[model samples]
Target: MSIRSGLFKLLGLCLLAGVLVAGIMFPVVGAAGVISNQASETVESMSSSLADEPPPLVTTLTDREGKPFATLYEQYRIPTTSDQISEAMKWAIISVEDRRFYDHHGVDWKGTLRAAISNSSGGDMQGASTLTQQYVKNYLINVTYRGDELGQQKAQEASLARKLKEARIAIQLETKMTKEEILTGYLNVVEFSRQIYGVGAAAQAYFGTTAAELNVPQSALLAAMVNNPAVLDPWNNPEKAKERRNFVLDKMVENRKLAKEDAEKFKEEPLGVLPGGPDKPASTCVSADPAFGFFCQYVEDHLVEDLGMDKDDLYTGGYVIRTTMDRKATLEAKKAAEEEVRKDEPNVANTLSVIKPGKDSHEVVALVANKDYGTDSAAGQTVYGLPYEVFNVTGAGSSFKIFTAAAAMEQKKYGIFDTVPVPNFHVSPVFNWGGEHCPTRPSGVRTYCVSNASDGADTSMSLQDALAKSPNTTFVILEEETGMGPVVEMASKLGLRKTMASRPADGRQPDPDHEKPEYSMSQKEFYGPNELAPNGRGMFTLGASPVSGLELANVAATIMSGGVWCSPTPVLEVNDRAGKPFPVKEPECEQVVPEELANTLAVGLSKDTQPGGTAASAAAAAGWDRPMIGKTGTTQFQGSAAFVGATPQLAAAAMVFRPDIPYGGLSYGGPGNVHATANGNMFGGMTPAQTWFRAMKPIMADLPPEPLPQPDPAYTKMR
Candidate 1:
């Protein structure tokens, strides 16, 4: 047959097919009427014989403070129409998937026949899909394993019955709306991955450009993907993608949609990427570090519930996440950190944690030295762990002293100058792994001036001297006298996380069994018996129970914020599609301790940086301009590190780790197997301190220097 004659015949068949569908619509009226009527009756009967079912619940995505982000899909009866799509999108899709899309009722008989015939010699059957078929497959059928609601895109499956249902729906849709409208709807609802649905998402994903800005070449490429993503996924199978592109170009040429030469040129075009990032909405990828990962996960968990979403819906659906993250501080610190971490090199894994303070916000900022910064860190690569996982477990060290001191003051354990048995605590019950006692034995007046690891000598010093020097003996005695019950209560009140401490700790008594301490500590004036917490025992003082930098920093931020509980937040606000604010509850915290307590804590932080102190190195590291007050902590094998402090403008925390990396991970890979450094030793000070400096310097540079919030001048005498 002549080309023109064949075209005419094809057009004629499509029009006739349209009429056939229309005639088949009314079960009581015409062709196949009786069978259609019976089917309707049966469907009604099935509907009437249903079991109990409620409406699909509405959930939401929210920010840290429980403000809404977006809703899961709301339309129950999935509907499709061309008006919901872009015009160019419709035309391009039609040109590639079904050249006779305008005239056909739903299915293209000639294309189906051609595909069937081609399949006889096939590796795979070429799909002869119409816009209608695609719509059915996308929303109503398990063309690729569709289940009751939405199923994860898993193993491959096909649906002949769904295709039939699609044809019927298309006939009904055609009567209800114009060909243009149906195509439009199809474009709007098409899944483009990246959590982006339809033409809108495609425009953003493909070109980093908008739907309105899509040129013919860009439009055509996207259109091709609609038919078979494997053939067009730009990331994988680029050769097949090239083939698909060329095929579309050929179709456009045949349909007079493009000139033959132009089509060739377009086909040769090296696909230029969309200028911006992917259309997928970004979310915080939490790491195995149990501290704040679970906290952030808690935020997401609540957001999903608030947004009324199912797990699948939240994971796959596009959402605008709002957070209280002070990204500037978090990232700057991350960058400054570990610039030398890799310098430590050779599989020496490391991690970092940071937190910010707010009126009702608290969250981790940086995990490692940029380890989990963007889509990269232990978090991004998912190497550290899944959401709500724990990464590092470190001994909190002297930072824990802040709480003990608070307890000392509150419980009247000892006054600042009040003398306790100022002896080096090296031989105290708390021994290191090799049965070596801490070197921090102190004796007479001069003994109190000694360090926590004093080579196990005897010395005596003032409580003030002990506080500044981190004399393990000071805290041990204070803990021994002051008691664990008050410390647990005070720590929780200050925002410390409940942790499973492995040891009864240095000076904490009434802890026979080596159980973890309890966040649930009460009743017992001591930190608690091991019975209440299987993992809370042993080292109660000296930070045997682990706490994250996030929590510690939050406590510090609260103190810095002048006793007003400034919760750390990872998000700022959550706005809707039109940028409307959602209602959220305000978070409130109590001032469990007096403001004077925070003042004293800040005092200790400041004095520690003076001449003789645990963190003299860290204090000297900073220029004193953004003058910081931070405490350092280190774990044995894993070598965990954390520092929480603030400038006048911002308050944050920095945490780093090598996972449970053998404290040996802190050493070089060569012949010199440096065992490990002091508990107060290692790079936590250098890296964590640097991380804090980097984060604070930039922020400080951006603003005018404000005077430090000085504590009460007269209250300087803790005694």
Candidate 2:
């Protein structure tokens, strides 16, 4: 062995050792870089996908007084800005969850190293996720699992890949948002328990206070629950929850966020969790106050149908709607109807609608019924709201005679002093009749025999006397003199028929013995007639047309307002999330008839409240201290009874009938059935008038009395 041989051998060994080290180190470094790049890309993609999306928030509904009545939400979260969140909450969460939350960019290397060592050593896996990372994970979970169950499960799966993705995304989020913004977003999205997302909702569910009002101990408890809500739910696991709360307090103390003594004091205090077990927001009419149920439903319907608002958006758009409902009037009207109708005939259905006729907007003060409005099977009752009022046209009975009287007066051909024939049974000479029972009639004329409530009425009387007595025969003759065209037009001007046509001047007379002659008159004939006649087959004065309670009330209101007709409205205003006002339809008003005719008609209707009048007893029973006027309507066979009345300030209408039966079937009751006792049948002047009187008394209390205007001298001169 020589010196040269020894040196070459040592050099060869060193070179071989260098090659071995390079072989192991190169692949390990390259693989680490590749994994890091993949994680970054995944995070960037996730963060970018969610950057433009807003957090899910709750929409609230408030009453006219700005009090919250209902809420629509998917997660019950009310998002709050950082300014609205308490400092104690932010510090407590940061101290316990991530001590170096503000110090770290997005990931804490020192914490990660410690977590890795702890996890690899077979201990419970230590969480090294910073608040930013947690926020990223929460965002992913929310966006992915909002409406998808499977996606939610995948978002929360315990996997290395998921954790790596969260970490990468969190780092990216830090650059795009400030620490305070990130903290605010994190607090808003973190789940504190089942179906409880965000600090705002958690505060309400757990403590009944707002997120901005949480005390130190309260915040610490909430902060502790974020780790494992089920295990630390104070209501379900008080001991575990207390322990975790104390642990969070201790961590706060370690971070100098709270004093050690303060931490000890908090630990000694009981859990003190005030949990709202379940929410009972007024989401539907059934859940609303019984008195306001129908009114609320009316407002809701107007929003969806009349205003063209999306139903989904209305429930969840976070709108703040201010309605036109007068709470006092509503409550009073409801009480009046319930006390009057519910006691006598439980089976009888009655509806009362009151409106304030305004110059530009007519507010529906109240819409009430004897039965509650709802969808519960046990709550069996029809929903009598706007739909019922505007569509379900009930027979107006004698109350409709005002139109005939108005037509004759407006034509200046007849006045309150004019005399008309009133017979116990009189048929219009215009209706053509066939069969041997019918006497010979004029050409193109019919005999439609109509009877009055009283059998002693074969007399001619002044117009005012006939009106006050509500004699069916007098109005029939008045219709004959006035012509059906002007009569129908008078009713139409006062918002009677949605569609109207001229009555035929002549028609074939039907047989007097013909059954269902009224039914033979089709809807087109009644609504879209094409000729002129003395009367609508003599039934027009008997109130054959179907009109809703609302329409009837408006008619009375029109007279009360001296002929101005204002469309009914339920909502006053609507506001958006940013407190900006949304456009709302104003009340529409138009003069339907001349003030002179309206005043004269009003004076004629007022006589019904005097002695020898049909509704005189009801008017006295109403106990009104001020002058009031109304008409009583009783359909044939007593199928329905209605009273529409008004003071100068308020107007209301009520109807009593069996909702389940057709309009012309069995009476509500007669002589010992329900409505009537003795040998008498129910009349519009009975229950309906009583209900109107009772409801109007309370409603009129707050309104100053204004005497109804006198009829103009031109119409009065005929007297």
Error of 2 at 534 (Å): 14
Best by lDDT: 2
Candidate 1 lDDT over 1-719, as tens digits, reads: 99999898678656655554553355576767777777655433322221111112223344344544333433211222333344555567788877888878766767654443444335233376677556544643222233454443311133333333445555555555566655665666565544445666567666676666666677787877776664467666557666776787788788888788888888888766543435433334332232233334544554554344455544433334566534454345545544534423333333434555444454444333434422333333323421112233444556677777777876655544455455543343322212332344342111112234554343766555566666565676665566566666677777653232222222122244435333223223334434433222224556534454555666777766556664444445544433476444434556666676566556546655567655567666666554556665544432555555664446655555444333233344222111222122234455555556655667557778655456553334544
- Over 4 Å off, model 2: 1-79, 91-177, 186-198, 216-281, 343-346, 375-396, 407-413, 429-447, 477-492, 496-526, 530-546, 662-682, 713-719
Listed in order, each prediction's TM-score against the native is 0.68, 0.71
lDDT of 2 by residue, 233-267 (tens): 78888899899999999999999989999999989
Poorest 10 consecutive residues of model 2 by lDDT? 499-508
lDDT of each: 0.51, 0.69
* Residue 118 local lDDT, model 2: 55
How does candidate 1 score on lDDT? 0.51
Error of 1 at 290 (Å): 20
- Candidate 1's TM-score reads 0.68
